[model samples]
Target: MPPATPDAALTSATASPQQAAPDAQGGVVLAPVAETPPKRPRAPARERTIGTKVAGQPAFVLHSYPYKETSLIIDLFTRDFGRVALIAKGAKRPHSQLRGVLQTFQPLSSSWVGKSELRTLTDAEWVGGMLPLEKTALLCGFYLNELLVKLLARDDAHPALFDHYVSTLNQLAHNEPATIVLRKFERALLKETGVAADLGRCTSTRAPVQADVTYVVDPERGPRPERASDPWPRVAGKTLLDMEREDYQDAATQSQSKQLMRFLVAHHLNGAPLNTRQILVDLSQL
Candidate 1:
């Protein structure tokens, strides 16, 4: 077309770059820009999972603590589920049904829901064992509880360890010697958790522990000869062999086994004293 006015050209150039249509009033209209939708937040992962029946499983309450005003959080070691935490709602009430059934070391048929680290305990029915642990045995039972609480991780199942625990409790309840039963359980716990040292063989010589020889228990590496400078206890080869066979009945084996396990457990515990040990020591003198 012929030369346009400066104002008209400027208006055409500055207008939006989209093709415009005529309005009712014969004015050019620009299309409206679309607004973007806002983003939504993601939901957290569900803790519960679907599963089949866990009915009639053998289990025991390892320990428990007050959760709030009327509830308690129980740590259980079940035959199938291993170590799991359960919230026993209203378990703290004076007449709560669960109050009588959830005592430690008593066998129970426990039902819980969810695959969460903390499961909700649905039901608990007591299954009595031999008899209640009393005197020294009771303290030993608490010592076992403390070990499990410190070493075992939540929701991690160890069926063999569970069985061993049940057996240990039964032994303790039957008035078995505290030192013997505790040593057996401690060794089993260590083995089940994959921290047990080789008791039958020498680390350097790769030979069976001989009854005539004296050896040092290396907590990290197993049994070896006592070095000229090492301060750990030197155990007899017979003691190592006895430990390997779980034979604490022999007098010599019992004595050396205690010293060996003490060295090994203390090494793993890194000088952190077990309160139960001190309690036992105090009670023995009285």
Candidate 2:
């Protein structure tokens, strides 16, 4: 303490800087220091996009809806890409090049772009089909669309199902019995979606279904015994076998096959009704 250094004095002076000043009430007062504002981080740049062609892709229009004033939002079922959404700019115009090309139940080759789930449709060219669906078949075609919409996930390809759908449409267009064609398609749809069980064997026992035995068709499961308590339709093993072969020619097979498919489809639909089916029923009633 005899000769305090200048460094020690300066340190002692600044150490109690707050206490150095006092208000009238004897409360310590602190001086404000200038603060540098925090710098904000910059945003990341967006990825650059380039369009490419999807050549010779087989596709069909599942459904289309109006968009804006001059465009349409088309849901396409492609051979290799499953269900896809495409924006058809200017498709609503009176003379749009794609106006006549984008139609349901008709085969098509479509081109589009964009990496996002919803793509832009650049072109659509119709490939002539077996024929256009009419009468009861028209409503049945919509039923197929509804099934695809409800069951199939977007952009998941099923080439075999796509082929089956085309063949089903052709059968309907050619006036193959409505019920038979529908049953075949429904079976194919369920099988392709991985929901259908083995038609030949019992779920409980590994035994093959005998042609004479009466069995109960379980929707979630496969065929089993027709128990005394359960109220579901009891189908013959022969009927099930006929369905497996897609042979609906026999009168008995056709009648029973309809009931079987309807039961199976209703089970998977979870009580949500198909309105197109009701239309077909009503027309048949007339």
Candidate 3:
């Protein structure tokens, strides 16, 4: 028989070496070899990392408040990073570069670095293509910023919603109907956060909604036939479908969708009041 390879011989047995007696002619006798333990591999060394750094990202200042004596705590809405709280060191100082650069409603290219929930702002510069929001549009911009600060969680990326927000701002700046703009933004926010339901379908029937039927939207579920005891807003099926298509030209669609969206937003907020909403409501605006 062919001899076992050296590896096979070593692996096939774990017994101690046995001493063999000399042959009749007294030839040199070979002893069985004991198995040796396999060596363990050495682990690779870990790299020393300090923190994360993001640069030249699209962003906007949602809100800011004075921090310490010369710094500011800023709530920033970023295209890729969502809502982030940043400490803008020396931002409140009269001659600080960031003092003039960190205005709200302006597009910015920003850089930040940190490992914690709140980050350090490294640099920011205005992108400067968008027209400034003025008059009621300025208030509306603040309202949008408020919604983002309240609804979105830190470090959650919502690139699509961010784009929609820019578009909404542009529309509002150009004097488009504020009602339509606010409704669209509210719907997008709810849908992006997984809080919105399909308005064209009935939750109970598993079928398309009838345009003439009156329904109440369940916050956790979708739309269902209205009950007399239900406390939710009653919306006509046509209004729901119109909102689904984003067509608010009809007066009834406009009025009913306003109430429906308000109810849905309030439900998702869990009784938390929106300050900007109250201000607009007091002014008889959206």
Candidate 4:
């Protein structure tokens, strides 16, 4: 059998032959000495961390408010970081670099740094490929931003939804029907947040929704069979399936889907009004 080797802990404590003393009987005995406890490996020296620095991330300014005399606190929807609040110092000053570049609905590559929920905006560069949303589309753009700010939690990234937002912006810029465009974005926003999904199925039965049957969206659940006295908007199951497919070209689908989505979003908001929606609705623009 191979001789057993001392553990590293024991090896560190082994005495030198010179340290052993001659006993009265002739055997060499080591004098008792305090055994050193194994040194706890010190945690590696922490690098002096200053702050979390993010650079050249794709984002859009959802909204910005005057933070103080010369600064603005911005609500930004970032592709990778979801919703973020950033303090753009000196942004309100006439000569400030961020004043023109921080416009809402414009795609921007922004850099920020800080450790708190509200970060410091270090830089912003416009990445202009899509056209600026104009006229009615412009209001619709603000509507989208309002919905996101209302629904999306900060620092929660929804990459798919972000891509959809960019696509919706492009579509709006190109003069796509606003009704369909807004409905699609609303549906997608809900789906991304797990507030709505499986729109083509029924909530109670978990069965495939029939095209001809009327239903009401439960918001928490998917869809429920419409009851006689139900006040919520009743939508045909076909309309629900059309929403699932993102198709709203048909007049009935277009009209019915709008009411359904409006109810669902309102339910989730718990009567909190969408400002942009109110503006568009007041003007009979949407």
Candidate 5:
């Protein structure tokens, strides 16, 4: 819950999408890439079911665990259906078709059929083309997955956030600054989850934030002038404004936003600890 200490707070996919390049204004911009549509599922008759089928759904495997003998319970982050739990029958079998298909950070077009909370995965195939995450980027990818698995609700849809997620992955794979990529995604995730508030103005006065003024962000509200007794992280108004514009060009914004987001995320989680966050903190990465 709050990273165990203030220092903990301070320590903090999709297709072959094109690399992200900064615009003339030096803002990161993702070039739109064409996505190859997923082919229809080809499965045995016995595996096919009519129970509310969703086919060719863009997705990534957030996490999976062994369920029974050779089976797995997969948590998927889908474009249209948010997070979903599916039973991957026989995935653990050596020759199972899904053995190579279900992997984290790899794009997939998943098909399933079921009305229950745990659906049956009928078919899945890797939608290749994107760069694979390596080294620190790989760990950062896991961190992103952890956040989605912990924060996003099942069956909820967040299309914009999903797109941004893809772009974030692309940036990370390209060796772009991890801190900036993560900060942007965290902000987007918080916004999509309906927790983030505008940081460009004061919650109390509704006046534009002055760059040099120090402020404290209220997770439930927005930013406000800091008081003597406030215990939250005190960030400069410039940091808040820079984060609002998704700009991390400034060194101060990078450091301050990290701590601010760490505190806010912990607040929203109601004191639940983020495992990957702790790992990143230990590694001095992120």
Candidate 6:
């Protein structure tokens, strides 16, 4: 079934990565600064497998909207189940426990049930500890949620991506730079979705990428060196190499990587615009 509302269509709420920097041309290069914090402990009450009834499955409320006069429909990203839609029954009441818990950005251990397309959120608890994002970091955090809602399919599991997400969120909560964090997450997202071309080797020649060449990442063909003012978005080979190492210290690399990613993402999205992306663009800080 389709979502009760468009993914995050009704979030009239305020919310909340990386060693990042402001893009000289208006973008962000968020890469990991330090190791990701430890993973949240698995909810002990969770069933051994992902089934109709989930108990304390580690999850995040990606986005939510009022479902009715007294309930809410939420899109959740679960550790095992990927993007799952759950109805937070009666969560709209001012006194409801779920009201405070079903919030974006914060981590939670959630319980839910139902074999249908949409499930029911039975329980949620805050997995507190990390600092909340402020100012720019908070917007970047919402941008992450937007990407997940748009790119990932429901019920598909990518444990690696999920772990990266947890790490990304933790980094966002801290003083780490933001550009590197977003870039790393964007790369991970593309990789998980199977659309990102490899950065390690040239696609056409299968030659290992060198640190000194200039290359353009072919969305279909992989990274190829720049040629005579190459048309496709361009980045230095060192930048690609640095990105492969998950590093974004070089200014040229940060600027170029941001452009390369935007082009590839736009191509893959087939002209479907990302609203958050546009907001970032308008604010000149993606």
The estimated TM-scores of all candidates read 0.77, 0.78, 0.84, 0.83, 0.82, 0.79
RMSD (Å) of each candidate, 1 decimal: 9.2, 11.9, 7.8, 7.1, 25.6, 26.5
Clashes of each: 0, 0, 0, 0, 0, 15
lDDT of 1 by residue, 96-184 (tens): 99998998888899887765568788899988755888878888888898788777777667888888888888898898788888888
Evaluated with TM-score, which candidate comes out highest?
Answer: 3
Q: After superposition, how far is residue 243 of candidate 2 from its true place, in Å?
A: 1.2
lDDT of 3 at 202: 99
**Best-first order by TM-score:** 3, 4, 5, 6, 2, 1
Per-residue lDDT value at 137 in model 1 = 82
The runs of at least 3 residues in candidate 1 whose Cα sits more than 4 Å from the true structure, single-residue gaps closed, are 1-54, 284-286
Give the higher-TM-score candidate: 4 or 6: 4
Which portions of model 3 miss their true places by more than 4 Å? 1-51
Tens digits of lDDT, candidate 4, 1-286: 6665677548656753335789999999877656667997765332222247788989999988898899999999988888999999999999989889999888999999998888899999999998999999999999998899899999888999999999999999999999999998998999899888698888899899999999988777778899998888889989989999988989999989888888889988888989889899877655
lDDT of 6 by residue, 1-286 (tens): 7765654654523212256777789898766456668997685543444555878788988899889899999999988889999999899899999888888888899988888888888899999876788877788889999889988999998789988998998898895777788899999999999988779899878999988887888787789877886789777788888888888998887888888888888887778888888877777676
Per residue, candidate 3 scores C-alpha lDDT tens digits across 1-286 of: 9999988888767557666768779976868766789997754331112247788889999999999999999999998778888999999888999999999999999988888888999999999999999888888889999889888888788999999999999999999998889999999999999999999999998899999999999988999999999998899999999999999999999999999999988888878888888888877778
Quality of model 4 by C-alpha lDDT: 0.88
Full-model lDDT, candidate 3: 0.90
Candidate 4 weakest ten by summed lDDT:
42-51
Residue-wise C-alpha lDDT for candidate 2, range 241-275, written one tens digit per residue: 88888788888887787777778888888888887
Off by over 4 Å in 2: 1-53
